[model samples]
Target: MDLFNSAQGKNISFVRPAYFIIGGFIGMAHVKFYFVFLFFVYVVSVLGNTIVMLVIYLDHNLRTPKYIAVFNLAFVDLFGNSALVPKILDTFLFNHHSISYNDCLTYMFFCYTCLSMQALNLVALAYDRLVAILFPLHYMVKVTHRFMLTMICSFWAFIIIAVLIAVGLITRLSFCKSVLINSYFCDHGQVYRLACNDYFPNDMVSYMYPVFIFWLPLAFILISYLYICGTLAKVATVQEGLKAFKTCIGHLSLVAIYFIPLLIVFTLMEKIHPNARIINLSLTSIFPPMLNPIIYVLQTQEIKESVKRLLKMDRKLQLKRIAIM
Candidate 1:
């Protein structure tokens, strides 16, 4: 393969490989058991998220701005898990480790886009809570259906474009060296680092992507909650403050579930074993999708009631059908 790309007029060569070997749980002890657990998680995630979305769709009471963010979160979770877990099973469990270069980039695009949106969706939920508690009187006006939809759509658009740019940068890289990806999937960092040519652009993106996806969204959520706390403190009674805080329990649980594991894993990356790091990263990615809907269903009264109402309506419909028959 040619080492230099004379077409660039910079003596840089592009040696793109046909396929990259994914080092997913290879040589790991009892890894199949983990994959089985991941399969169970994926199945529950699909069912739970689908049910959440269905409830929000069917229940007119849930057709509010708040549920818009809820619905979006469920969708993002479902999409994110679908993009990740299935591919992991196929690649590692089935021993189909060699993925085409373009396919790898495509995989990274979907996984990262959904992951980014998951964090931003939490930000949307936090914004909803912030407006609800801090400006209760004007909550409806501030968090209208149109406004919520626009916010979620804008997030989707921005994340899609940002992830696309990241994937595009990988095309410029020449992976003349080892094409073995150390992580589970076609991780952007692991893939780009294998490039024989300069990957400065990819490296810059690696740092910036986390800030946008993790740090900024987390900072926004924290600041919003701080403002919420300040507002609640001014309320006339302790009970009133507690009630307002109660509304945030579901969102808080979600925020913690989604962000805490990621923060811990990244902070402790250097000290952890590579296999352990990969497992933690994989868990952090898959667990949130499975847990998000469960948290909302259990911690959020509104969703719980919606689910109950949906079940009752379905039961009534079935009884009426039997009566007619």
Candidate 2:
């Protein structure tokens, strides 16, 4: 990959940023087989997200605003993973590391933007649940189709604008320094660190998205869920309280799964150790897409059970109609 330096008459690389690849001077196969491990993880992710989307899309029981929100989450995860994982696999497996300026820009833009939007979606979903539970009488009106659509549009618009500004600054940068990315793919921090010019503006704009995308949403979600829990407590029925608590557990588990790794990955990138960087980064990008669906289904027994019941009903009706005919 240093050939780019000679061909373009510029230098870029950080003294073989593969410290974490084969174990970072540590004898762990986790670093040695990172590519194979990631391949299995990505396959499960694609299948899991695809199954959620397909089940939700084809099943009438899943057409509600709740699962539509989930469908959106799954779609975002699928696309974001698709954008990065394939390229990553290519790099690690086939030794195809060179990327065009435009390809790099597109990859970075979508992956980063989708992550922002996904976190926002979860935050919004938390609010949706609060509205559905605490103010049951007004759930339909509050989470109406038109309002959901508007929120979706607004969220995308705001996030895309933020990402565009960051990415635009990146494109204007002269990469007169190292081209080697210390991570698996084109991460914003790694790229921003490579620019040879004034990186103050870049730093100000670079990766500041986590504050907006993660911390803000995380705070909102935590508060909303707390409210949800408090309100659920006041209800008179034990069965009802238990049921609601079960649902909350599912959402909380998922919230932890999504946010914990995210915070860890961004924070750990500060370390000069490549092993910490690779492990954290890989889990942040890979695990959420793979595990989010399982959490959604397992946590909310009603949704998956509803899907199953609806399928059974359809099969019975079809058989009955055929017999009558």
Candidate 3:
């Protein structure tokens, strides 16, 4: 790592943490397979999420404040998947295992920042649905465009500050030697473990910070769901209850895919094999982005109809251009 120049103009070389070793199971064949599989994942995820965001943008009917939260969630998935999967493809397919210290930090910052933002977006989505169903009369007043914009802005600002603080603490530590990070990407947990100084404070901040940052939003989502469920149970008809449940299915599936494997890895982090841990991380990171739009298209009739209508219009426009030519 290049820290600074001395008064004597000597380029002082710091003990720069060099290449991080990304864990993979088995031989060269596995690398090729991973490359193909993950490339497909990245392409499909980006395309799907882009379509979701575009439909929400183009359609006047879907311009409610709740869809604003939904659009932000799509943006989060696009951002996170873009940050992570291409690097994995490079690492596996081209044997580019080495990531610079600066690149690693950039990767970690975006990954965590997006993850934090996604959690908050889900929390907002849950609250939106809760308001719509539980108190339909006040839903418009409670979840206004102004309110959604404020929440989205606040979430991004908070994650930026939190990541900057953590990275600031990381920069203060002295690394005595080139350290090998045990994962594919420069995860804060993987990188911070390489510091030579007193790691107690870093560990404390790392472990304690997430409970409030991640779990608090998660808890709010859970409470919102609980109230939604309880309120549905009291509805006069089973069809009404089912209709209410249908509204939440997309968000519920997204939360399940995003968090369940992550919870499993968190529970078994210390005990799992390095390859297993890497696999879990990759799946949890990549799967949600890939599945999110699919979930909405499948579960939400409005989005499905909107997508079909858009595609039909696109086909018609293409034919008209062909006729003119």
Candidate 4:
């Protein structure tokens, strides 16, 4: 927080965020508003995910394997946003692609790597559903708490490997010729465009790895969920099906909202649709952090009731403390 508040850091952040708030994402008018918005997201996302963790930790009934998986998902989103959003905000709000070479490399690699953790998280969640529905008894033993820890560790380690591979490839090349980057932030794909030396390996890793690692996992998860959906269709009891449907709906909504805009924005970047960039960025960066908490509140009965009761209890406690004073 102190870093962001520093006069220098604050100055650097001002140049990056115009892609969304003022609707000139490509025009590069004011990155300051964008960083302000990102700071807001960081606080809210951290708090929102923490609330989910607290609600689950406080409530014994929420200790089921399913909600446990949800806790992991929340954790992933929290850290993922933390890693990427703030740095991007700084690039604009601070400098016009003015990041120190080392800082840019570190920031870009780690941010994307952290975001890749989400790929594995969703896959893990999908498998959780598959086992729960098709083989409940086995799901318990297979998706045990220890097993969850292993998944988390392995996923992060692999993410590091991917980052190293991409960055190692890029840093080996030269970029002294044309330092000015066109993108609002320094995505390596856009960075490659500006590099003066050969970037064939960088290009290959950039082009292929996102597909092999992130997209492949996402596709598998979608396929698994499709089968899960079909199985859900066969539930003999309407009440049982509705219960399952409600739980999954919140996550599915998040996936759609996150993925669609990303596909359109990144895919169409070369085509140069400023409106799409603005819309896509707002949906991708802003909504998920702020609105996802609302998703959990509406979807999970335990959380909704807990929040309501928490609010009531807090009010009473305040009033009683006031009377005594």
Q: Worst ten-residue run, lDDT, model 3?
A: 1-10
Lowest-sum lDDT 10-residue window in model 2: 16-25
Model 3 TM-score (2 dp) = 0.89
- Model 2, TM vs. native: 0.84
Cα-based TM-score, every candidate:
0.95, 0.84, 0.89, 0.77
lDDT of 2 by residue, 137-235 (tens): 999988987777677778889999999988887765666546666667667777778766677878887547667888889999988978877887777
Tens-digit per-residue lDDT, 1-325, candidate 4: 1211212454432221112111124455565676686778778888888888777777677777666666776777777677666656655455444565566677677667656666676666677767777666787788887777677678778878887888777656544444555444546766665555577888888878778665788798789788877877886377877777666776677677666667777778789566456546544755575556668778768778877777787899999999999
Q: Model 1, range 64-91, lDDT digits (tens) per residue?
A: 9999999999999999999999999999
Instruction: Give the lowest summed-lDDT range of ten residues in model 4.
Output: 14-23
What lDDT does the true structure give each of the candidates? 0.91, 0.74, 0.80, 0.66
> Candidate 1 or 3, higher lDDT?
1
For candidate 1, what is the lDDT? 0.91
lDDT of 3 by residue, 5-110 (tens): 1223356433444444554533434557766888899899999999999999988888989889989999999999999888887776677777766677778888
Stretches > 4 Å off in candidate 1: 1-12
